[model samples]
Target: MNGSMTDTKPDTKPHSPVLIGLAVMLVAFNLRPAITSVGPLLTGIVAETGLSATGAAALTTLPVLCLGLGGALGPAAIRRLGVDAGILAGIAAVLVGLLLRGFGGLPALFAGAAVAGLGIGLAGVLLPALVKRDFSRQAGRATGLYTMALCVGAGAGTGLTVPFEHALGQGWAAALALWSLPALVAVFAWAPFAKARPAAAASVARRPAPSLWREPLAWQVAGFMGLQSSLAYIQFGWLPAVLQGRGLDALDAGYLAAVAAIAQAPGALLLPTAAARARDQRGWIVGGLAAMVAAFLTLAFGPEILTVPAAIVLGFASGGCFGLGLTVIVLRARDAAGAGALSAMAQGFGYALASLGPFGFGLAHQATGGWGLPALLFSAIAVAGAICGLGAGRAQQVGQAARGP
Candidate 1:
């Protein structure tokens, strides 16, 4: 059992870590495009489909729920197939989902979004564990690479989907479908790495069973993940609309949202690397949450002139917290198995909790007929997230915290 859990090291033969990392990066790059692309084009979708605002919100919310469900199932997939195979399967699912969403009408769109979200959920759960296993010595760097890739993909989707729709002259459907190309590319890029793993390593890659559900630290980590994700998804699903309400056009709204998403890139790349070297990440977590709260206030009632800067600040804060959330999952684990279990806990339940953000935010806006209430709510959430992060950002490992003397 010990050997199986701890023996996931790469084959003795010289295999290029660079190649595997690139494969991982490509796969990561495909994770967010399906969801992000829909947001910028949501106005056209609602206009064409006659879907209500609440219904349009489902485009973002449903996929996130599926992502949580997928993450919950990721451990099983990883156990059944090694990391490479599991992630490869996920990337393929995403491609199929994108195709379904792009070609079909409203029903197919929602279904495809859910399917793609599931794929992202499964692969997303295992990514941290893969870094912990294969790049143990440089887990921070590997995480930064993939997370940065995620930010780039998200930014591309937010920034380009509208233009793609205009360029293709095919409406939102074509724009949504265009994302499948990247997923297809990821699948091809990942296949070789998945196949290169030695047969012997497959048996050894099985994670050891750990009762992470019983751990308080694990729950704190999950709360942090869910809360931060909630804020992120809210921005994805509604930022353009909010900006439009504030007098910006759809194109400019999307560009600003793109700026916010792109801003996360630097934070995602830098925070994990920085936190990995720190004895405790509490200070970083606190500071990031502080920025989030400040940004929320500025967005809610501050002068309109400050919205751009507020969005940028919010992006940095959310991005830093997100990267730190993943980093703690790795830092809190003793081994790959532990990391896998922690990831399952953090991402699975975390996203389940997160799925409500966009949906509820939409409902609140509908009820209040404005963004004020939701903005205040988000500020409170940031505070709660900080509290959770404080506990999760502790220096000790999950097992150690759980097995208290």
Candidate 2:
């Protein structure tokens, strides 16, 4: 396939919107499982991998950082491959990377994680565009479905990792490796779309990605996205271990952690729709921050017995807050290109910020005698998230819309 996107029209492509949408969703479901599933099984991996504290934490952060990198680079990648082929390549890369991380040991784990991150990053940038492209009339409803699927995937990955680890009594290696199966499933599910789209016959030079760093709204959107993402990644990376430290058995802690994550699917599914229907969402931002503060306070000062409900409430709010944060990106953008740039900006900052969560939580917990200080500190981060969200959620456009050349 060799030509420029400027020289071709995606309109004449043979695929239907349903086909593209489903393909995008299947790819979305695969993106998180590898990066996310390992957290619930982190203890076993640390023991098996002989990782130091930093190495243990890097398992989570490296992928997150790569997610950011992937988002930043995905647009250029798309220009080279065109949209449909680029997606297929990303899906394949993640599948291979998942296997490498799972079966190959620590170095391979890092490599696999990085590769998987790249795959996810590409998919992340591309899918949002596809949503804007194929589902222009249904962006709100479409985002809800896609975001719901994101939660379901995250939760399932978190839940299954430990169960699989416990299953063969083989520790975390096999459990961690098991996540690759879904990517394989996605590759097959998405095969039809790749088949339908004909690649261009001549290659073209990739254009420089437009700069987004100078935009004020870009920063605000990124800040809001990053702050919520930091908290969510904390849950993905450490909440299971946190609950276990409080005395639940492995299985009990896993389910409780799963309980915390389960609410995310619904919250992500519903919150953006609610926010989109309103003119001002500053109230919801403040409320989400407040709920998270309450949740952390429960973890810090409330009885240990309340961990279950605390986890659920916090998890629910995290997803909802994030869903609205994502909504803010699309709503504020002036065009599909603007939306695309903002998405990259937000995710690049968001995932890098997210990479901090697990490592910070782990270190703070390690340094202190208990979870209290870390919870308090994270409470501050959550508060910051609220402040940023409120600002970002305000009604506004990306910038002055450009007149045609």
Candidate 3:
């Protein structure tokens, strides 16, 4: 077994673990909204500033791309600062980026987004490992809550942005910047992590992270993550635009995107819980991923009438895949460190590579001048996710695949 993931005996002894769990969920809930909230509002910002199509796309693509790079570095950052402190730093980074964007114009918009992505990406990787460390016996349940919270954050970001903008009479920039408030709240809410004495967490650092990148299962997991993520990021980045391509207005496009965004919460809560109860994750992995494929197929082949339900199914199914994928990383590993390593390996490359989905879809739209065929591009990516997820879902320890030199 991977040294880092060695499962400890569950402590049945009572303690109020729910408070800590809630705090962690709150943190999870804030992770994605800032990143996703901007996507639906992209056109408004672009139109006001006269940003090019490439510039508008970069706002979305850059954050996800940086998520990949930041995932690789998160493990090291947590080791240096402790999980709580690392999260605080990440929160602060995102806030700064948010403020930059609020200041208006192109330079701040792109530069701030890249910086904020780095912060979100780091926090994103750190959270799951921390969950395993804190709630060992209930990794599945904890991950379910965490993933659910994440979906809620995503949905809120997509669902609320335009309304928030209009309500405050602040325009999209000011409304977009308001998302940073949650980051600040997250930083304060996690102050307990900073209180962890140095000696208290010394054990976490000494037990070296497992060699996850070298493991075949690790690669398989990362591949599933990236492949499905390519589909997801495309939705976050282009679904509204794709809908608009179908003869919908901008407001109509945003509402359609909202349907997909809101669907994620239930999937995040349900699928991972189911996967955890099973003997092998392969069935859940294959089946849940297939649901994602079906969602895309409905969109591709069906007429406009199918748009609403298709978005909902696609959103829920993808969130389920994410929750299941993350659970597989935690359950298949032996400990917190193993979970951390898996998180890093899977998300780092997964998201970086996944950024191509939106880029390709946008490029295809530009090249082909329509969304009809470009939507098919994502359908193909979903099929690839199924293959990768099935392999990673096997009940094998990531550490069992290799030896130390």
Clashes of each: 0, 5, 3
On the 0 to 100 scale, the lDDT of residue 151 in model 1 is 80
Residue-by-residue lDDT tens digits, candidate 1, 95-131: 9999998775998999899899999998899888778
Ten contiguous residues minimizing lDDT sum, candidate 3? 1-10
After best superposition, candidate 1 residue 378: deviation in angstroms? Answer: 1.1
Error of 1 at 275 (Å): 1.2
Which sections of candidate 3 miss by over 4 Å?
1-15, 197-200, 402-405
TM values, all candidates: 0.95, 0.89, 0.92
Clashing residue pairs in candidate 2, if any? 2-201, 2-202, 2-203, 3-202, 3-203
- Quality of model 3 by C-alpha lDDT: 0.76
* Model 2 residue 78 distance off true place after TM-score fit, in angstroms: 3.0
Off by over 4 Å in 1: 1-14, 198-204
Clashes of 2: 5
Worst 10 residues of 2 by lDDT: 200-209
CA shift of 100, model 3, Å: 1.7
RMSD versus native structure for model 2: 4.4
Candidate 3 lDDT score at position 142: 78
| Residue-wise C-alpha lDDT for candidate 2, range 1-405, written one tens digit per residue | 011123335664555556556666677778778777877777777776688776777777888888888878756665666556667878888898888866657888889889998888777766655555445556666776677777778878877777787786766767777888889989998876655554431121133334678766668778888888888877777777777776777777777777767777778777877877888677877788788778756754579888878978977887788777777777776545566667778887777787787778778877885887678767878878877876687777666322211
The predicted structure with the larger lDDT, 1 or 2, is 1
Candidate 1 clashes between residue pairs 3 or more apart in a chain or in different chains: none
Best by TM-score: 1
